[model samples]
Target: MTAVKIIKVLGTSAESWEDAANEAVARANDTIDDIRGVEVEDWTAEVENGAVTEYKATVEVAFPVREGNP
Candidate 1:
């Protein structure tokens, strides 16, 4: 049996939602390990003067729980 944990993250990008998701995961990886999965929970965009300026994503990231390290 294995233990898992989930965390929510928000990421933004000038390109697309995919990139935003990737960015969130990448940033998470900087401090986290054993990445298992990611769920894109929401999507949004930033508008500037009636034009879409950026894309944003809300994600749920999952990974195996580690023991006795923290």
Candidate 2:
């Protein structure tokens, strides 16, 4: 049997929501192993003078728990 865990993270980019989601996964990869997938929960934008200055993403990352470890 395998176990899975979910963690929430936030990422921001000046590009787009897709970039922000990618950034979230990339950063999580730095510390997390056995990553299975990511779910983009929400998206928001920061506006500056009626223009989108940044894109923010709320991401849920899923990873498999190591065997023989709790």
Candidate 3:
């Protein structure tokens, strides 16, 4: 049997939601391995002068559980 663990990550982008999600995954991949999937939990955008300035996304990242060395 295999176990999976989930982690929450928040990322910001100046363009779109896709960029935000990609940013989150890129950050998680920096220190983690065997990344399984990503789910967008929430999204928000910042506006300035009646224009969208930034897009933020919260994602749930899942990875396979690793066994500790004995």
Candidate 2 residue-wise lDDT at 11: 92
Where does candidate 3 clash, by residue pair?
none
In terms of TM-score, how similar is model 3 to the real structure?
Answer: 0.92
lDDT of each: 0.91, 0.94, 0.94
Indicate which candidate wins on TM-score. 3
Residue clash pairs of candidate 1: none
Better of 1 and 2 by lDDT: 2
Q: After superposition, how far is residue 40 of candidate 2 from its true place, in Å?
A: 0.4
Q: After superposition, how far is residue 38 of candidate 1 from its true place, in Å?
A: 0.4
For candidate 2, write residues 1-70 as lDDT tens digits: 7889999999999999999999999999999998998899999999999999999999999999887666
lDDT, candidate 1, 24-61, per-residue tens: 99999998888899999999999999987899999999
TM-score of each: 0.90, 0.91, 0.92
Worst 10 residues of 2 by lDDT: 61-70
Off by over 4 Å in 1: none
Better of 2 and 3 by TM-score: 3
